[model samples]
Target: MSDSLLQLSAIDIATGSNPLYTVLWMHGLGADGNDFVPVVQTLDLPATPIRFLFPHAPLQPVTINGGHTMRAWYDIQHTDFIKQEDKAGLYRSQRAIVALIEHENQRGIPSSHIILAGFSQGAAMALHVGLRHPDKLAGIMVLSGYLPLVHEIRQEAHVANQLTPIFMAHGSYDPVVPVKLARSSLQLLRDYHYSVDWHEYPMAHAVCDQELIDISRWLKNILKEALISDHQNR
Candidate 1:
């Protein structure tokens, strides 16, 4: 990992040895990389080792939280996300994430073998950056968050990931990031004919056991497909 690109330290976990694919997961606002560390063991994945990279978001003052400094990808100006988005912050984080992807590429893992996963604010960043990423990715997993920069995504989305599989899981009783926002993002993706696997659980702004099971299945399916593609290309 590049210290300049990723200012904060990250927690690295591998299911086993000889990892073939990487999942770069980001945490929700105010949380560090360790936020989702425990989930690694909970998901029932295949026997093959999978690398999970959880990077800590940079510390910055969040407007919605009374301008108190916290670890967030970007600042949330108000409750209405469509208005007054923190574009500068979002783009800054986007570049940093791209650099992280490049770092993974240098480690013998191609862009197509990488997955972007995140929660809440981090999920927003994943949807924002993964779609606009220059190269194709294995998949994107969004948990309990809405897509940021809704007006700009349509114009800025890259053609490389036009058909990339997206797994969006939201909570029906989410108080932080409303389920309605997630559904609206889903509707937009569907409108553009994007392949999105949407799931909703009757819970709050948090991950559930059933969601973890579903995520494990999704990871296995996508990673298996990526491995096949890798073999065919070689």
Candidate 2:
């Protein structure tokens, strides 16, 4: 639980632009924070100066292998309803999320200017942590990701003021996590009274062009609203 500074690192594009917002993005299993750098660039972020926090997951043993050290926000164990637990992985990454948010606060960015995002396993962590965030965030983006605890989330999720706007996208042909699973996840959130904007692209388990486009649009809306809210609060 002590500070290790190992959660996520950042890539600063558009250095000339005043960093107006912070986005904490996590990578999929076995990958580091750098995995999503391409997507960041593809967003065509302007010099408006946005800080991208690409947190590296803790190195731990994966179930796919004999306990080896690799980047993973948590372990997947087995898909059984009772055994689909992340245990230490989730708690450790949660602490890292806390550290990252605190660091952003020190940088003069408020919680309203922060966005939490991730893909695959990282995406699950994003939802788990972002939903439980005591303060409202600029937004929460989940790509090819599902809820870590569907039942527990509905029971415990909270936001400060505005409803937590979520963007959920999946690939129709995704075999790694399966597109149907993503759809089911979206439906479940909706059934639970969560606000979610859902999308599906004809691709595999990885990100696609349509997904990126939607994400960009989603962020633009959230950023615009965040700026307005900031000014109004002032």
Candidate 3:
């Protein structure tokens, strides 16, 4: 529960022995680390050698919600369906993410063995920071996510994540972050020569069962890849 760097509280979960993988999950606006706890357990990933790090977002004034103070990674411009944007908040959040990455590295988790993921606003930050950082992480999972900094990212994305596998899922009927946004973002990433795995669900602004299943399978695949790479290195 330290405010060092990102003001994040981190926990490590080990299954058998040494940690096999580290999955860092960030929650949506107004949500806390507990938001994804259900998904973590529902997936029954406790048996896997994965270290789940769910970081809490710092409380902030959300423009989209009448400036209510909530656990937000950043701020939105407004609640108007058309004027909602969060670039300023995202910039701050990315700095926190970079600091969080350094902290994770200090904890003995190699970037090659880490997975960056998020939901909603958190997902937007995930896409921003996960792709631009100088190091290559194992993977990036964006669930029910929208790309907030597409223009800046188009100008700023580094070559490192061009090959880093990204698994993103969104819901078609989502009124919050429209599915069109996600699809267009996927196209943008592809246009940028990024390796991305994209999928669409039938729900609205949320994680559905099928998406969860897809995420679980995708996680297992990346974990397998991590193990293969680790073994090859040894």
State which candidate has the highest TM-score: 1
Query: How should the candidates be ordered by lDDT, best one leading?
Result: 1, 3, 2
Question: How do the predictions measure up, each by TM-score?
Answer: 0.95, 0.89, 0.90
Question: Which prediction has more favorable TM-score, 1 or 3?
Answer: 1
Candidate 1: list runs displaced more than 4 Å: 1-8
Candidate 1 TM-score versus the reference? 0.95
- Which residue runs does candidate 3 get wrong by more than 4 Å? 1-5, 10-17, 44-48, 79-84
Per-residue lDDT tens digits for candidate 2, residues 1-234, read 334745455554433455778988888988887788777768865456787878777777777556676878777777541266865667678778867888888878788888999999888888888888888888889998888767677656774623778889888888777777677778877886778999889888898887788898898888888878878988
As a TM-score, model 3 comes out at: 0.90
Total backbone collisions, model 3: 1
1-234: candidate 3 lDDT, tens digit per residue: 123435666454445566657788889889888788667766645365677778888877777688788998877775432255666667777887778787778878888888899999888878888888888899999988866666678678877777889999988898888887788888888888888899987889888888888888888888878779889999
Q: Would you list the clashing residue pairs of candidate 2?
A: 7-55, 7-56, 8-55, 17-47, 19-49
What is the C-alpha RMSD, rounded to one decimal, of candidate 1? Answer: 2.2
